[model samples]
Target: MNEPAQHMDVGAYALGVLDAAEAARFEEHLADCSRCAAELDSALGLTPLLADLKESAPDPGVLIARPRPALLDGLLARVVTVRRAQRTRRLCLAAAAGVLIVAGPLAGSSFTSQNAPSHSTVSAAKAMYEEGEKIGAVDPTTKVDASVSLQEKPWGTHVALKLANVRGPLTCDLVAVGRNGERQTVTTWAVPAAGYGLQGAGADKWSKEPLYTHGGAALNRNDIDRFEVRTLDGKLLDTIKV
Candidate 1:
């Protein structure tokens, strides 16, 4: 990479904003380019201690009074106004909830016994399962063994799972439940020839082993209490609790 390009990339690396593909590409370059890597490391080390002079205030002045430009004053006023509006909205929502709680008994004497089940709720669940099935195909082995492994990294957590002995032909629809009781169904393409795959919450695609995480946005970092791998036939393969 050219010097300017290398210079621009270092900032992204320091902030941990570089994507997986970009990080891998830059690391490859760093391995071959010692001079660039040293410069990047030095810059990264200094970034945290650096101060923004513009944001710093001048020494205390008597009366703390100064003339500010009209545009700057207007901008500051607008920002404060927006903040107050947001606070008001939140207060309104809270007050409405309090009113509901206080008026609940007055609204209906038998409200407590008014709990009812709706078929629509069941239909919605059925639809979701069907959608999961369509997207997540089960592997054929029918018998499954599930295991989860977690590792902490600088940016977030990474997890790997082993789903063993899944029969062939249906390696597709396997879904694993994480410790949070949330289900992650596997799609056909996520499985490789290997017996393990990496899955996280909100993962758009499943891949074999070493699930990539960005501060748990892709998965629930807090809920990673265990791993449960299951077969397509809805049989329990195995589980490893955190």
Candidate 2:
């Protein structure tokens, strides 16, 4: 196949839309082509986003009494739209980060004398789940086991979460509830289908890494009373108390 044709198959291969034989051929090519391998990786990372969009998509019947587009076509269009939006967001975030870096020197001068206090705040923070807590089931039919750990920092709380048997591609939100009954969103993340388990069996799975939240409005370790794991649509999945 030509280079352009092979590149075009990357998205289809990543989405599992290609036939078995075609997919096998593409995989063989991917083994030797670094550029196509990178493309495949990028496409795979968007799987969860695409899945979330699929789940949240409005029902065609509810919109109008007319023929709906083919599922593949609809999915492809959604994927393109999401990719473009993601690119734009990344550019914006990069610009914002650049500003923070430029202003870091001025900000550091203000806190130069209080560096010890900031260090102490991080050192004083402890894991919220040092003692074992039961993982609550969000869906009655699905068995999910999860554990969360938090460490307090001067800026905000750092969270580590592990989940098993929770189906994907799902978007999860970590919410921190303060002593005053105020809620703060610590972070949100996407889990790919493979993260669920092999062949849908309940197996141990860990998150890619710890997520951090910061700012005055964010939750602090001492003020937080409980943590809840919820879906993007506000469905409660599990909870852990500090």
Candidate 3:
């Protein structure tokens, strides 16, 4: 679907009304479309206040209709721009090959997703943000920004990440490039404000434990030489070329 159609559901997203698939889509879209992200941030923040305004407004006999500038067209344009950038990146990456590593900042604002998730779905952001210091936290380095928490079960590692967004969105993709140059797709979406649960090849679920809020987590010293975070369509956001 086109970007505008994809984001027509922004209202539902901000209100926490969409289902899993829908919510993920909007989160990814918001990350790329800064305009929508900014606009939604304003609108969602005002919604509660709007309810208060309704409660305190003048009686029907003295009604006042506020004049606000229309933003639909502008919002659409921005979404298109973001989509084009994503498309360009995807096309470029399609021909490239390498292993994939991912990393980001964790010290800044204590992990928080710009958009909140409902009670049903796990809050990936909060979990990753707090996982470290609680248990299985990774030690951070000077150049590195975030930490990853891992738990061993019957499968591989149960992974939760806490990273920083010093600049724009942390929205990115994961691709596992093998020795033979075969790229195994991971996944990506709008990062939750707090943390997220990763159900990969091994660990297929998140735990029910509370996350750590204080210091205890450390960063790993390994240089993620092949790690990268890219947009949905494949635009490179950050790269660790070792």
Candidate 4:
């Protein structure tokens, strides 16, 4: 991407919406551009507020109209081109307001409304870990833990993931990568503030539980290589080799 195009991605980066490749390129640009770096820092401070605001948001499934990535990105880019800080802040607020505008009639939907569940709960993840064929590892630095179970199917592979020791207000995805250098998104989920798979005092019931999530890929078991758990912004949390 050109310098200007790279500058536009600040909002997406802040929102953790950029794919792996895009974020890497942007980080390269960020190392040199003090202006972009400053904007990024300012924008990032608002991310948790965005996530917090969405906690009770109405189901996205019901929205007939949603702002396109292009629209949001373009609006944010416009902010960057503005010479004055005052205009930058104003444009930033307008872009944010545009987002909340689309989250309309905003409140009161259960987590189930998101259509995300393959197993019962943390127990299912544990059962898969303890009782069956599985592979996994713990990241030495992040302390994020993950295990995967794979089953061959006529179409491809069925994957089960049990994730632990991760805290959030973060959205993450399970990715399957092929030996041939192809990647598939197996599944995705949001982690609440209470987190999963941690043992601690003063923790809520949600805090102590692990996550059991399932997804599928077109790659057969023999054709697959590894599974990675990552935040939406492309930060690798853990990798389980098959």
Report lDDT (CA) for all predictions.
Answer: 0.43, 0.59, 0.42, 0.73
Question: Which of 3 and 4 is ahead in lDDT?
Answer: 4
Q: TM-scores of all models?
A: 0.24, 0.37, 0.26, 0.48
Candidate 3 residue lDDT tens string, 1-242: 47987657664465454678877877888888977775575455445444543455566344434312233334334545665686688777854522111222222112233335443233444545444332222223312233344443343233344433322334555343333444433345444333333223433222112222212112121212133445576765443331
Q: How many Å off is the CA of 154 in candidate 3?
A: 3.2
In candidate 2, position 69 carries an lDDT of 42
lDDT of 2 by residue, 185-220 (tens): 766666555443223234432222222222222677
* CA RMSD, predictions in order: 21.0, 20.7, 20.2, 18.7
Compute the lDDT of residue 153 as modeled in candidate 4: 79
> 102-212, model 1: which lDDT tens digit per residue?
333222223323445343432222223322211122334443444334444465444433343433333333333556667654322123333334344533222322211
Q: Which regions of candidate 3 are displaced past 4 Å?
A: 1-125, 128-146, 169-171, 176-182, 191-227, 239-242
> Model 2 off-target regions past 4 Å?
1-142, 197-217
Error of 4 at 151 (Å): 0.8
| Top candidate, metric TM-score | 4
State the local distance difference test value for candidate 2: 0.59
